[model samples]
Target: MLPAMIDIGVNLTDKRFADDREAVIERAREAGVSRLILTGTSLECSERALALCERFEGQLYFTAGVHPHHASEFGADSQRALESLAAHPACVAIGETGLDFCRNFSTPAEQTAAFERQLELACSTGLPLFLHEREAHSRQLDMLRACRDDFERAVAHCFTGTREELYGYLDLDLHIGITGWICDERRGAHLLPLLRDIPPGRLLLETDAPYLTPRDLRPKPKSGRNEPAYLPHIARRVASETGETEAALRARVLANSEAFFGL
Candidate 1:
């Protein structure tokens, strides 16, 4: 049998799981999710992520950086703080940071600045990047392409991009992460062809927990919080679309994740 899968982008700090975080993790483990990586959206959350990593140790890892929504809060000392947090043994990657033009929570300029700074840090530290990109894929790809000379490794986490954008990142030798969003029957149906195009070794999977829940499951809470336990559904859908066994997909995704994050 293949080893249990790893979810490389969950936000455990999200209040959606406040009532039952342990239950969620346990359920995930029971469902064959052996590990999870929590995303730290800001300095405070980065510290919290580290604490959770300490609590879970071998089972949980974390990334340290600010989300684009918090970009305006960054300052001269912010990168220093991020540097310190990233030095933690549990901190495995350097972002959930990038452009989020879909919401424009932060101005485009500030988002670009934050994203560049984090990329520089990740480059200097020789750690991989866990990036976010929404409607800003074109700009995001432009920035990454410009800075491609500096980055050693990167993954466009929760990828929602055009086939061209996907190939653009692949051209830069970056990995791609898929989330429960791919299992959505609505807007995500279009991703099936793109899924077919991605090579197994270049693909990693995430839950992006407390966020995009897969369809075809029983009803969720009234608030609709997603969790790592639902990760298998993402695997199921991918395996179905790719015409590969669930076991093989699970193992390939785990290997891709382990190699990307050096976990």
Candidate 2:
């Protein structure tokens, strides 16, 4: 039997998959992706994600927090709303939240405020965190360090950062979620050398589907749309880069995901 794998993050709520979400999920199952945690980037998306999780039951889970890009939308009712959503059994984490200076889609002040609020939510909810970070690593690390003790767990999702940044996160005891970004030849080259630094139990894998499709995929999907089905493809590349066999890497990541998300 194929080794089971869990995709720690997938944006199934994206409109691109609206027409055939069920079929997309079925393909993931055939690919040996046994579980998927759909990412929720906004309040509306969070609600939609939860609904999908309910529809899919044991096969789908979701995170409940605002992304930095929508930080400005976090309002007086945002915390209460997120907290309420988090109460659901299917709500697995408290974020896709953090700072992203690469594109100030939201002002730094808004992003910081929103990130801190979500950190508090994680602390209160006792749920793990699904975090994001771009060019604002320094500030992001500082905030996370200050609040790390309060939260149970956290991961830097879709990580593609500097060596110093990687060590900083690891020092904070944050798990690392690697996406297909590692398969990119131009921008992802630096990560190949750094993979060895991730301790055995701290590494997790995700597809961040419909976004960072592995460039190395043979006969790449004609639609150019990524889905959870490609996680094994990403895993194969990770194994090649890290000098571990594919089965071993898949087993390690699956175990890491189970512990990190309490699956």
Candidate 3:
């Protein structure tokens, strides 16, 4: 069986856990999740993520960078600030950064600029890129291609694209992070074929918790909040869909996480 889970993406700075963050983490450990990588989406959130890392000690690690949605706020000094946070031993990667055309929270030009800047920083620090791309896969891929020489490690986190997009990412040698979104019947069915094609070594599992709760939940949390505690269900579903034993799937996912994040 898979050893346990390492949630590669989560937004703990979200207020959804204001009252019971400790309990949430306790639940994750109960579910066999050994580590949680809190995503740093903005400067403020990065700081909060760092604080949470400190609070949880070795159980929780964090990234230090900004999200594309906040790209408009990215200034010349943003890289320096991110570098300071990323220097912390608990900081595992640099981002949640990329292009998000769906939200339009930032202009396309601004997002592109910010994406490149963070990619450069990640290259400089030798940290993996925790990427987010939505409704802009073509442009995102183009940007990645431009930085192909610079970026050595990256994951397309919370991937929700088509099979072609999946192939494109894999062809570029980037890792794939799967979220509980795959458990949804309506929108996620299209991803089954993609799931079938992913090699054991290239896949990573994540909750993107406080967000995409898996469909098989029992005694569901009242607030509809997804937590790392629910990660095992994600693995189970992937096993069922991919025709692999759950134990084998779990072991592969654990290995993938270790290699991808250097955990």
Candidate 4:
């Protein structure tokens, strides 16, 4: 049997899973994905994720914050709501928050503002950060560095950047989350070499579900919606690159997830 694993990031609250979230979790359970941290990108999403966590009990936990795309809507009310949610037992982290300069769904300035506030919340709540960064590593790193000493912990969720970006996060003593992105030959090939760069305790695993389904999954799920069950596939790819057996990789990744998230 495969080693038990933890999917440290999952969008279980996404409407895509509305009809079959329980079935999705059951598949993950059968695949040996022992636990999940649902990603919350907004107040509505965060509330839903928390409700799902309560429904699923010990199997689920969630992060609470606003994503950069919705950064424009962030303000006093958002911060207050997130602060309230962060107090919940099921709320395990303080984000889905960070900068995303790729599309600028929210402008750089707005994204930065929202990210900074979420950083404050993380410190205040004593919860680790669940971060997102796409083409804004330098700015996000700068902001993180500024308050690195204040926050307890953080993870670069769904890291798909370059070696330099990976090094930047490692330098901050931050945990790194790998997803099915590494299973894709086109965009994720560069990540293969960087896998070994992430030392043991700092590496985490995730699916970023409803997104980033491993490109090569045979007979892909008919819905084409990613979920926690495929984490073992991502682990297999990581093991191949790192020259560790999938069993060993899963054990180490599970340890890292437990340590980072207190799972």
Candidate 5:
């Protein structure tokens, strides 16, 4: 039997899963993905994520914060809402929050302000941070470093960055999350060598579902919607790249997720 694995990041709140979220989750369980941490990218989604966590109980958990893409939506009321959400027993972290300069969906100023506020929220709630970053790693790291001593823990979710950025995050002792992006032979080729750079205990695995479908899946799903069930495929690829047995990688990542998220 495959050992249990936790998908540290999944957007179960996405509209794509609306038709059959429960079925998707069941499929994940059968595929050995035993726990999931739903990501909240906005206020509404954060609330919805928490509700889903409550419904699924032990099998589902969630992060509460606004994404940098939606940073414009962050305002005076945002902190109050996030704080209330973070107080929930099912809310395991404070984010989906950080800078995303790759696409200026939200102004840089808005993104930075929102990111800082969420960092403060993480410190206030004493919850781990589930962070996101793109081309804005340098600035994100600056802000994170400023308050890094305050938060209990933090992970850079869906990391797809360069070696310098990866090492920068590692230098700060931040945890790194790997997604199916590593499966792509085109853009992800560089990540193959960087896998060995991550320290054993700081690496975490995720699907970032309804997005980043693993490109190498055989008989790939027609919908092209990634799910926790496909996590093993990503894991197999990581093991291959890092020169470790799939079983060993799975065990190590599972332990990392448990420790990082207090699972």
Candidate 6:
């Protein structure tokens, strides 16, 4: 039997998959991606992800929290709703949360306030955090340092940063979620060297589907849409960087992902 794999991140609710989301999950199954955790970028998206998990039940799960991009819209009601969502059996983590200063889609102040609030949610719910950080790692690290002991655990999702940032996250005992970004010959080259530094059981894999498609993917999807189905393609590349066989990588990540998200 093919080794089972878990995709720790997937944006299955993105409009790109609107027409055929079920088929996408089926494709992931055929690819040996036996499980997936759909990301919740906003209150609405979190609800949508949870609904999808219900449909897929045993094979799928979701995280509940706001993405930094929507920090401005995150209000008191948003926190209340997320608290409710986080209580669901299908909700495995407390984010799609963290800081994103690269675009400043939301002001730094808004992002910081929202992030700290979600940190409390993770603390209260006793759920791990699915965190995102871009260009604002210094400040994010400062905040996490201040509150790290409160939350159980967190994964630095879609990490594609400097060695300092990688080590900083590692210092805090954060799991690293590597994605297809490591496949990009230009921007992802740096991540290849950092792979071996991730301690065993601290490395997780994600597709971040419909977002960071492995830039070198063969016969790339006609729609240019990434999905869980292509995860194994990414595994082969990650394995090369870490000096492990693909099966070994898959088995290691399966155990790590489950424990990280309480799956």
lDDT of each: 0.87, 0.94, 0.89, 0.91, 0.92, 0.92
Listed per model in order, the count of residue pairs whose N, CA or C atoms clash below 3 Å is 0, 0, 3, 0, 0, 0
TM-score of each: 0.96, 0.99, 0.97, 0.98, 0.98, 0.98
TM-score of 4: 0.98
Candidate 1 residue runs with Cα over 4 Å from true position:
219-223
Best by lDDT: 2
- Better candidate number, 2 or 6, judged by lDDT: 2
Candidate 3 vs candidate 5: the lDDT winner is 5
* lDDT tens digits by residue: candidate 4, 119-157: 999988789999999988888999999999999999999
Least accurate 10 contiguous residues by lDDT in model 3: 214-223
- Models ranked on TM-score: 2, 6, 5, 4, 3, 1
Query: What TM-score does candidate 5 reach?
Result: 0.98
Report the C-alpha lDDT of model 5 over 1-263, residue by residue, as the tens digit. Answer: 66799999999999999999999999999999999999999999999999999899999999999999999999889999999999999889999999999998999999999988999889987899999988888888899899878988889898898999999999889999999999899989889899999999999999999899999888899998998999999999999988999999999998899888877
Off by over 4 Å in 3: none
After the best TM-score superposition of candidate 2, give how far the Cα of residue 191 lies from its true spot, in angstroms.
0.6
What TM-score would you give candidate 2 relative to the actual structure?
0.99
lDDT of model 6 at position 220 = 80
Question: What TM value does model 3 have?
Answer: 0.97
State the RMSD for candidate 6: 0.8
lDDT of 1 by residue, 61-136 (tens): 9999999999998899999999998899888999889889889888999998998899899889988888988888
What ranges in model 5 sit over 4 Å off?
Answer: none
